[model samples]
Target: MKTPSAFYKPLAIGAPEPFREIPVSLERMIHFVPPHIEKMRAKVPDLIEKVDVVLGNLEDAIPADAKSDARNGFIQMARDNDFGSTGLWTRVNCLNSPWFLDDIVEIVGAVGEKLDVVMLPKVEGPWDIHYLDQLLAQLEAKDGLSKPILIHAILETAEGVKNVEQIAAASPRMHGMSLGPADLAASRGMKTTRVGGGHPDYAVLSDADDGGARAAYQQDLWHYTVGKMVDACLSYGIKPFYGPFGDFSDPAACESQFRNAFLMGCLGAWSLHPTQIGIAKKVFSPDAGEVEFARKILEAMPDGTGAVMIDGKMQDDATWKQAKVIFDLAKLVASKDADMAVIYGF
Candidate 1:
């Protein structure tokens, strides 16, 4: 464990000082772009407007031969576009992969200044974060960068899940974590091929009644994992996100899964397809009615203390905090979207 005196110190001489607090940004969806493809790279400028975080993915989907191309493409994408408030991120190859070293080196050397976050995949523990944190500091010092690039871990392996709390508190450069359900399923030897969402066979049947047909209601396979990740992240003051829902054909299911994560305290989710982008934005943003009610709560209890009667229900300090959550989120959504601002009466 790092001592309090050294926790915020730069790992390398002349490296920028570590951040005391993670920068606040409205990240509703991390839209993945396969940077190895030229056509996909062309869409990044427009994508910057639609998505909160535009991630150039150089890992899983890229062919082995195209790893270098993907890395180079991400650098070019970072250089050519000015992302403004929208985050520019990249999902580099995992630590175990041969391409991982070059992916970090070249991208940082070329466009470290514009890059917002580096999404590290399959991190098993705090050791992975420590390694990256030290390396980033060295690289940042060498490149004369002004700010530290944040590390976002992907919880894929079973060991990663087990060591999640430690990982969240691993470094001052830690931005957040995303739940990688497909790889996590494989790591845990779960009997399912789906990337995310609930499994049909993993359902519970209702009580049998006098020879009548029993109903089977499907449960989310990821609830426990998401809850665990959320708690660890919230405890450490980092964000938690839902990973990709691979079934592009089923928009309803994707919305449902995203909504569950949002209700459970996730700030965002991954969007692999263009259609899912809209769904993520809609699900992650606070509802208009809820925002209005939250506004009322704040008005009634200016200091967020004592009990008040609203709609025949008793509200105390607990409910005031709940209302603040919705109101704060609604304000963030309003900042980017003019329509939302009007609808939310912001």
Candidate 2:
């Protein structure tokens, strides 16, 4: 275990000190852009206005031959756009991949000042975070960057799930974690080929009725894992996010999965398609009615102490905390969206 005194110290000489608290931002959707494609890069300016985050994808989806091109393209994108309040992040190739080193070195060297987070894929343990943390510090020091770049891990491997708590506490650089269901499925030898969302096979049957058909209700395949991940992240004061939903044709399922994660304490989710962006914004943002109720709760319990009746339903300290969560999220949404501000009556 790291000594408390040294925990926040810079890992490399001249590196910026790690953040004590994760920066406040409304990250309802992390919109991914395939940096290797020119036409896609052209859409960045417009994309910046829509999404909370713009991530240059340098890993999985990029062709192996275009690794260098992707890196260069991400740099170009970073240089081209102002991004303003929208987070600028990139999903670098995994630690074990050949492109990993160059991805970090080139991206950091060229646009370290503009970069917000480095989304590290296939992280198995704290050791992975530690290595990246130290290396990032070194690069930040070398480039004379003012702020330390944050690390975001993908909880994809079985080993990653096992060591998630340690990984969340690995360093102050941890921005958060994302559940990479497709890769995690392969890691655990799960039978599902789907990227995310529920499976029909993983369902519960209603109690048998005489001469009647048994009803099967599908259960969320990711509930347990997402719960575990959310607990770890919230415990460590870092955010948790839901990853991709592969079936673009099924918008209803995507919205359901995103809503589940949001209710389970995830601050955001990845938007893999244009259609998913609206879904993420709608699902992650607190409902105006809920926010209004939360506001009423706060008004009733000004000190967040003692019990009170809200619409004839009793609320106490525990419920006060829940109300605060919604109110806080609604405030963040209000800041970013003028329409939301009007609707939320902020």
Candidate 3:
């Protein structure tokens, strides 16, 4: 079969990300704060210390009447605070919304230099990302910004999910993708109203006649889409993130959803509330015991190409590759946290 037309064709006006000696990508918690709410902004200093990324909302979480204030507040907060290692991102209004135009212009023009990522919601296809790419370029020039702002396309529509590969490879300015399960459910006309978690009705059940008791098996509504999204992002050397889990009180379910994403090759998942922050971070970070085992495997196989015997188990090139991933991430996390440094034995 022929590859999709968009494959191997990157958009104009963007450059591929340069490789660094120690590549650092935030695959943990992304904390969301609504700029329209003063309480949220007031928590930034504390939140920044805890979360890897703190994204200010100018989109769905903000009311239509309060969009202007949200936009202004988002930019002002960026100007007011120093983000340090914590990335400051803003989820702008969708392209179709009236507020989006102002959002793209004012935010990028004012705080573009200070911002790390600009999230575009309800992105239907590559065209939506292209629109933002061109607009940001022009704004960068107009504002004389030193660095171009990065784009985070939210996959929340059927069309967007279908064309995810194209969207991921659209531009070098493309930071990564986030799965927006809520809007995606609406776009697909799903029966469930819950945001991002499995619904009981949308599950498997035991056979009535053969079984003594009927059981309902909950499944991830987004398994297929997320699987495809992760593959697409990895192919393009970009990141894939799982969006919010609204059942904040059910810590078990939230952690389960996040673990599913992490196991399925997602870099991280979004935290809609402070309650979910620890869950996301813990799930995304490689396990301490797992990391130790990986290090042992690496230490035994100093030569990464050959097969070896360790603890009565055969280790080979494939195992080495997997261990390398864990070791790299362990080192990366250790660089950021003193406790992690001690845990990782750095």
Candidate 4:
């Protein structure tokens, strides 16, 4: 993964590191709020305390004529408030859109210092990241920015999925990648009319026997893509995220979807509505019983080598790794919440 010579390389001597490697636990939920909506911006400060990441959506949520308004709105909102460690991010328009270039220049030149991740939508390949990397570098240099702005790609197009590994390794400033199911479906000519949810009409059924009804096995449409994405991000040591689930009305389904991603190695998912925020946090966080079970396994394997039996279950090197994953997340989440601290400590 050779970095482009024209890309922004941090100068060492006096300033802090230009990029932030966001911890997995800190990114379990990214709430998408439209920047152009005054009502939304008015509610942002309150939302910040609840969500891990509040993305000022300047892309799909904003109307065509209102693109410029969203751009200006992002800068004003960014400067007017402080996001603390609850990362402040913005999604610019697509690479081929008219709004994309100005979105970067105006926002980055004005308040680029405040932004955590500049998310680009419909990224087709490494070329998209390379272009953004160089453009951001140019903007940073021109604006006299003290730190480099990081990049996140929306892996929506078929080409993007095909080359996702390269995209993950595309830029030195790449912070993460997200799975965008809506555009991905349209790009692949999928028949689903829904945003990102699974369709009941799509399923596998066994053959009927003796006039008995066949068993229908419902499946998740996003499993393969998300699993592949997790592998790609892990290989590059960057984060991977599950994109939005538009079914705000179905909390159970949303939780199940998020849980699947968490088990598959994703660090987070998008929360489109307020209802989705708590669901994501709960689903992505380590389960209390699971955490206790993991602790038992860890205690049983104190030497951290070979296999052992714990509560009638076989504990091996693989089991130890899995337990560590859950416990590490538990420790990180505990540092933020006093209640979680007590639970994890126990």
Candidate 5:
């Protein structure tokens, strides 16, 4: 079958380049409460300072009757305060819902100036992104906005997982794709009861003494999806992020999950609870020791010349490139946290 005009673009080859000049670390999703606006407002001052991105969630957890108030609260918050370099984002109602059009109209018309990104949930293919892209462009043009508002897709459906590459390449406004474990589990009819993460039922055990062992249980429910999503984003020159670590109480498990993504080249992970914010920041940012070592590699290499040995490992042009990634991330973290420079010895 012939590819649609929207999906006919050549496949993106090789590793993806970072999409944005600055790093984005979305603040843990905020649940809206009409009566708690004052409380939420009080928390914003501190939250914005610590997080690279603050997102006001308009779907899922918010009460149906309170959507308007929550939308208004975000507008008021954006108007009343200056977030400095921190990016302000929002998760709009899904396209299939009655509230989505209003969500887009109100958010765009009201605070389009301040918003940096619009997170679209349960995106199935490039068509969904294309519709949103055109609407956003029209809105921005009408509002006299200079910068185009970017879009982030939530990969949470069977078709979405299959067509992730096309969706990532759908528009220039596409920023990144996040692994939404909960909805994806439901859509795929996964057997796990947990949102996303490891399951006890998915494990392995050894047979009796001297007997041969066999492959046993299932592994990470989202690993295959995450790996594919990450590859898609990398191929298309966009960022890949781990959506949410829903277990709020287990900080250790959260760290492990975030670390897995970090090692796999994810830019960042979502923080649903305030406690997870520090863990995400700590795991995602390059460690102080690694940062210092990366600086040494650059100093030694100087002009990207010949290879050398560092910590019993071969250090060459390829190693230098790898080190630079760490150095750049450290620099970004330092820019956000003045104290980070001192802490990381940058």
Candidate 6:
């Protein structure tokens, strides 16, 4: 019989993640005041059904005095309520903060079994992760917990971004990384006031037609960071997630942003508002036409053989691999929704 270490060895080295094996799918962290625990609890049922993960925001949004209350409230809520399969996660205070040790102590001691992942912010280097990993292991050992709680780092600082690959590979508990664009912008000294999503000041110019004049416009300031972060996460065999789409009212723009990340190999994007949830699900889930085409391609290439023509493009091993991406996502999403399964013919 293979030992647990040997059993897990194959999965440690950039192995293709099992399809639909999403550990935790979360929307943005929901901020609430101490007095709003009842109100937050009222909202939980609706949120759990709509989202795959719901994280209690304990770090930034909570007031200093209320941090204690929020942490206590989250623990109580975790004990009292059942989030079912919708993974429960929390954004703990940074390790440098005074609240860091207490936050971990309380969460791990009280409700460690209930928590899925602890989102650590401003992770500058591997040492940050190593600290958390050791602490978490000690906590797990003390609590007699069977499963280890995962750690997720926010790539928000320049140092963090610079050492993202090392950070991702820091520990077995490091499950994924998210791009925290707001803090990242501030850390990088980007001249932007908004939290995240779009920036009008970052754009490109289209050339003038008859050498009359040139026009410039804004583009995504996050493109470079997103691409770099995605590459790092991919290299380390972890999931990459777009942090937040702050434009809650503009679903179209949110969808466009989420779609960009989806196309670039990100697993998911953050949804701050309830309205943005559908947009993320729609963008991340494969479209019907693409799913049909991929299905057709697989049927046509039963042997997975040489290049064949389809839609004026050569279909071969490479193309089939691309088609599998769509097919797999379609199947994954279809498992949860019968309507999607019917539409995709899975």
Tens-digit lDDT track of model 3 for 185-275:
9999998788887887778887897657888898889899999999999898888999989887899988988899888988788888888
Clashes of each: 0, 0, 0, 0, 2, 5
Candidate 2 backbone overlaps, count: 0
Q: Candidate 5 lDDT, tens digit per residue, 252-336?
A: 8778878887778788877777887788878878899999899989988988779988878889998899899899888877877
Candidate 3 has its poorest 10 consecutive residues by lDDT at 14-23
Specify the highest-lDDT model's number.
2
lDDT of 4 by residue, 1-346 (tens): 5555523345333323445454344888888988887888899889878888889888997899999888888888898888887888999999899999999999988898888889999999898988888788777777777777788899899999999999998866888899999999999999987767678877899998999999887789998999999999989879899999988888888888888888999888999989998888888778888899999888888767899988888899898999999988887777665676786675
What local distance difference test score does each model get? 0.95, 0.96, 0.83, 0.84, 0.77, 0.75
Flag the better candidate by TM-score, 2 or 3.
2
How far out, in Å, is residue 164 in model 6?
Answer: 1.0
RMSD of 4: 2.6
Q: Ten consecutive residues with minimal summed lDDT in candidate 2?
A: 337-346
- Native-to-model Cα distance after best TM-score fit, residue 172 in candidate 2, in Å: 0.4
Error of 5 at 29 (Å): 9.5
Worst 10 residues of 4 by lDDT: 6-15
lDDT of 2 by residue, 1-346 (tens): 7999999999999999899999999999999999999999999999999999999999999999999999999999999999999999999999999999999999999999999999999999999999999999999999999999999999999999999999999999999999999999999999999999999999999999996999999999999999999999999999999999999999999999999999999999999899999999999999989999999999999999999988999999999999999999999999998889999997
Off by over 4 Å in 1: none
Determine the backbone clash count of candidate 5. 2
Q: Which runs in model 6 stand beyond 4 Å of their true positions? A: 1-36, 210-217
Candidate with better TM-score, 2 vs 5: 2
C-alpha RMSD of each candidate structure in angstroms? 0.6, 0.6, 3.5, 2.6, 5.5, 5.0
Q: For every model shown, what is its TM-score relative to the native structure? A: 0.99, 0.99, 0.91, 0.93, 0.87, 0.87
Q: Please, what are the lDDT tens digits per residue for candidate 1 over residues 1-346? A: 9999999999999899988999989999999999989999999999988999999999998999999999999999999999999999999999999999999999999999999899999999999999999999999999999999999999999999999999999999999999999999999999999999988998899999999999999999999999999999999999999999999999999999999999999999999999999999999999999998998999999999999999998888999999999999999999997888998987
